[model samples]
Target: MSLPYFHHTPETASNFAQNLRENSVEYVRFELPDLAGLSRGKTVPMNHVESYTLNGLNLYGGAVTLDSASIPIQGTGYNEDINFADCLMVPDPDTVSNVPWLANTARVICDTKWYDGRPQPAAPRTVLKNILSLAAQMGYGVKMGHEYEFYVVDAATRKPLYTGQPIFVTSLLHQHPALDKLMRVLNLSGVDMITANGEYGPSQWELNFAAMDGIAAADRAFVFKNTVKEFLHTEGLLATFMTKPYKGLAGSCSHFHISLYELASGRNVFLDAADKDGMSPIMKQFTAGILEHAAAAQAIWNPTPNCYRRIRPHTFAPSNVSWGVEDRSASVRIKASKDKRQHLEVRVPSALSNPYLTAAATIAAGLLGMQHESVLAPERSGLKEADDSFKKLPTEMHESLAALEADTDFIHMLGSEFVHVFQTVKTAEILRLREDIPAAETNEYFDLY
Candidate 1:
């Protein structure tokens, strides 16, 4: 297949416009990833797309910084502080693609910027790009692969399509026709899906795509999610990436695999031939960096209150800051430890994490480790929960946010403005949810109190 025609320059934009016309494309959706990893933008008619692609689309300034519920939170500086201004959404031409399900509709991911052309500091995508830029300057390029688990249910009833634990069950994988269709659509949309399976939960499923460069991987993840949700919605089904959708069932996770390659030699920096463990010095230091900031980074990895429910024992989710060679229970699992394909799979992020923010946090933490030349700690074995020696992860959203705020270095690395806005928005979410008393709380305490 030919490479995607980027709409970066006027010549390319013209070519894209001509191609759209030749292909009879009617509408183009300009999408920006918001704080919740949700797509926020406007769809333009084909006639107006070229101009918008060359320039930008004006959107609400708070679009990318809005709360999880997409509400404008005060003090974010993106909203009330700026009197609710407008921002520009410039299409990253490299992200242009056809919207498989929509008739003659195309989609292009965008970067958020101020009306006057300044970068949108709090935009999740922008934060990630800045991190990647720093890594590039440090003489390395990152490769990231995202593995997402989601549950499929009836749209109106909101219940699973099946009723049994079916992890890797072949017949169960085909139980829902939508899964196959979704997979095909994703691949057609350039996701390059490599695997699909039924997960631990009754109707939960995971589909993985091939790894790509840092920005591309995150872009694919963002597209994969929005595409799955949007496509499933049209079929009268709901595909939710919520961390713990069911009370007793397994929680969904968006485990990300990361590796660094020397830009000069294009060699995986994590591999070592002489070392007994095959972990290069750079890899060990990077792992140490991830371990050091695990708590603080959890604010982005598992952003929502519901995310904490997934970090319990025996859930294949890490409850502590731990790392081990090929240990799934550890927060950072080393894969292909003795091979050229060595990489780290960070299991902390919930399915609901913003892809951009997650990538940024992971890269920033590793950069810190490299800067300090930190040594990797002793590895944990077996179920990490059984090991008390490991440091505990924050069990709540507020706690994670507090950890993030306290990590001055991490805060500085990921931009203080972005962190401040993130904290403000998330804290607002926490406080808003606090007012609501759930049935579980009422049932457990009302009569006793």
Candidate 2:
């Protein structure tokens, strides 16, 4: 069957259907984004394409309205008593693609909204839209790329089957057979993967993709995560994107490399080689803004309780708020590129974070810097030495919540409704973890550490 093209209008949709029929598409997958940036979807036979494509599908808004555990909060009016709202999942024609693993199956990502046509304020995609709209007013566009690290383990035994020590050891560089298979699948899916290597943790691996514009990058990240998990499952293995599935080794991180571009000319606005640090004035201000607000942004990036455990010192993780030149310890690292592609990498976020929230927080922080003309202090160096100058990141989930609550300005920027819903949901998660002190929980995190 021929590949399906994205359609944006009614005419385009009609043409797309005709093309799919001509190419003998057997089924379609409608993928909807949940609050955590995970895609949940259902498959329908090709015969229903016309009805599903034009009218869209109905989903229980409760699917996304709840926390990770599927519990709905009464205060949010999303509980069972509120009769749980219904929302529409409208396919983004541009995101249509054929799944390489599933024969004759095409998939399209979707945006959700209320049945009455109001946007779901708690939707991760909508929150991103708010940040992008703000970026538009500054005559700049945001571009980002994510470096995702995960652990591929034996599905049945739930153990590391690969030939390597459980921690950082130089002798563990030999390629694993499963990793080779994963790379082949990634290649078939047309992902521009830049690098793949062993991480400091046991059974952990990292994959970096080429950067793209905001929306496209987010789409790629969403597709990449789902594709990796599905492919691994077929091989009787599990791919975990959890921040700290194993406690002692390095936690999985989803580091974002971000840059700003001029909307009209497509020029890299963060570049200025003439400066001593090779950073433009605007770039300095942006980095400073992010560092200043890094504590508040933790609630969005390191939302889960497990996430706070990964921010400790000496783990190659960012334990405090600081900026540096090519220093990985700093929350924000300024790298000097010989070309105009220079960008900054925010290293504090974990793999389990919602992509939309991460991007929005970064954009909002940078914009705050621009608005206030924030000036960055001298760039720090060295990873081993502790710097007391910058505020330390929250050591626990509850502390992170306190930091988030104190930053009213950033919360307001994210929309009061989103902040409230997110806080409520996350707080509930913390309570759940606190209640269940699973024996596996302590062993899983500390055994390898």
Candidate 3:
């Protein structure tokens, strides 16, 4: 009843639980986001919700450190030798939403914490919470909108459900009944959709989300990924949020739109009437921060052996750490709008990246820039092909890991334990892939990225 930062007041929680009971909710899924952007949690009877909510559900620490494939990577402290320790997965009452796809079930996202009530430092949600706390200390409240692009394809052949569809075109969606069903379930789950469209790739579809604040946004993103996969698999279809599911396909990028508000005045700090594109001096500094830390953050933003395939020149995903007004090519893109509705659209994170970790990394860079009054360099508008003229980011997963390792201060800021867990797990995967690369044709990426 008295949890800090995870948000539910006792009055509201009791009311919600009462409603769940009256609604005859049979099962409650207590979900947690893992390192590889996958949900790892257990479901309990609704009768146990009160008990778990009060005492906290005991779950393994490796649940947070496991690789995309659920393989216990060699140095994460979650493997056989140094078995995972028990951590508390305390459900946040505020995150409870009906599981529309499941029978009589309701899902709630949780916050991982130590037995002593301190946040589980390495958990993705915990990392985001820490970054949000830091932003609060800086007197900024973040409002973020996340965009996801995914592919729906035939289960056997792995060919697209629809091919050669133009971007933003919805006509092709009619060919995929599974996708049409997914839209209904998403609405039933109370996840708001801003737009849905067929993207540049064959069978690739993009979904944009309405802006939400802090952990709410993270929760929505986590749910969105799982929900899509669940619905597709149930419909006997394969859906992938992988950055690039195929070699020749144009990659799917997950873009995060960020806007900061002054806590006291309730003003959007990124908005300035005097500045062009409404990017204020503060916003400029934040952009500079993201540009400065782009290389290091790529480990968290892209974070896969296959992610490199999408970060090349001419790909919509960023290849350089540059910002531009109305330029889709730059990593930090300022939209073509001058109104107060302006926000920064970060174009680096891959569709497969852990949303919480990605958001934490992004906020960390921006806050660092604000703290130091970092200055933005000249905008690289319309010169995306001039890759040599821009600051390039790491192209390989190992190089990204090295960049992350070299960024000691940021690693410390995001928590050394988290970085260690991430690095060890990724290192093991990199090694494994080098010896025997996984089939690039499989669509089982949710658990086998």
Candidate 4:
């Protein structure tokens, strides 16, 4: 019933089993975040959980590279190449949490490994872990925060809970009991939520939680999305993190915040009082790296064809690869606090992005910056989208994927295996999208042709 922070071992698993008995737990959901960041795993009865926790459970290896439709793609080197292999889902005991809304149910996050005991390199969570390891070797520890915007709607009707563009409206914030219930459950489940409010779009809401170190932060984000959707579904409502569900409305986004700390001294490494802009040289280089690979990174950030629609002008989404201090208009905004609190806010990721991949790609790019001592361009003043000085980002999923394929340096840093699997899965999605014709397209071309 309490938040657990321990490694998975025989002793720890035994202790966890004892805790489950104490809490009268009936089932444990051994969940894995799949390629599209969907929660996919097995549910085990409490009687079998201890053994599974210690020994791990079997899962389809192809799950790690499944498309948005949950179909495993071929030629990804995970499915057919391995003859549809099974991967081990080894539960990380530290990620155990009580399912506050589901009585007698608990959840534990897991990492995937091949049957032969090798970590699944193409797994999003594994990719993130490797990137964090690289950062640690460079004497830096990463702190991360996520700001997520999503829409709540009636599951049957698919209509917004309310109809208004009321950002930060007090009455609107409390308009739904679902919001209050969600906040309460998340806090009870150890999300450490800080704020929940009505966003710019009707039925849209933004909730934020406390930051944590690298892998832990990404785990929290993955848990947050799954919890919201599951709990809301039980309440006869649907919570969607889709990039854009309605036209002429604000799209959902998950903005990521990151800053590095000196591992040896345990001090914030991005702050520099002597610098004119109050940013340390490391921070600038990190920003430079992010900008340099923004286009390629977009393949991960905006994975789906629909996700690119959220990046248009005046949508509060970035259209160009640019950074500015406190500039929401820029792709990467430097929240300059002139103190330890200073960090980079990457606003490019859509809500549908896998948190693990986002963190991995961001960290990988920044590390390249630090490694090469990359220089940042001058900060721009006006709206980056309007500024001809700034270069435009990839406008479509295909373009982004191509950019990702071309960026050998970035791909090398992120691990070619992971990148290859990601590209294959996303490319499959694009091929499927190309065959589908929307009603708008039919309306515009059917009669004319």
Off by over 4 Å in 1: 1-9, 445-449
For residues 161-261, write the lDDT of model 2, one tens digit per residue: 56444454434534456667777677666567877777766678787778888666777788788888988898898999889887566788889899998
List the lowest-lDDT window of 10 residues for candidate 3. 1-10
Model 4 residue 384 CA deviation (Å) reads 2.2
Total clashing pairs for each candidate: 0, 2, 0, 0
Predict model 2's lDDT versus the native: 0.78
Q: After superposition, how far is residue 321 of candidate 2 from its true place, in Å?
A: 0.5
Residue 62 of model 3: what lDDT? 71
| Sort order, TM-score high to low | 4, 1, 3, 2
TM-score of 3: 0.93
Off by over 4 Å in 4: 1-9, 447-449
Off by over 4 Å in 3: 1-16, 77-82, 437-449
Total clashing pairs in model 3: 0
| Candidate 1 local lDDT, 34-87, one digit each (tens) | 999899999999998878877778999899988877789999889888889998
**CA lDDT of every candidate:** 0.89, 0.78, 0.82, 0.88
Alpha-carbon deviation at 25 in model 1, angstroms: 1.5
Tens digit of lDDT per residue, candidate 3, span 1-449? 12333644566556656778998899999899889878889999977777677667899867888877788776665556456677788788777877887899999888887667777677888888888988998888998977989888877888877667577776776776777788878877768876778889988888776889887898898889889888888887888988877877788878988888998987888888887667899899999999888899999999997888999887777898788887788888886466657789999899998888888999998998999899998675466646677868899999999999998768867989889888998998888778873564455564566
Q: Estimate the TM-score of every prediction.
A: 0.96, 0.91, 0.93, 0.96
Query: Model 4, 255: alpha-carbon shift in Å?
Result: 0.6
Which runs of model 2 end up more than 4 angstroms from their true locations? 1-9, 80-82, 163-175, 438-449
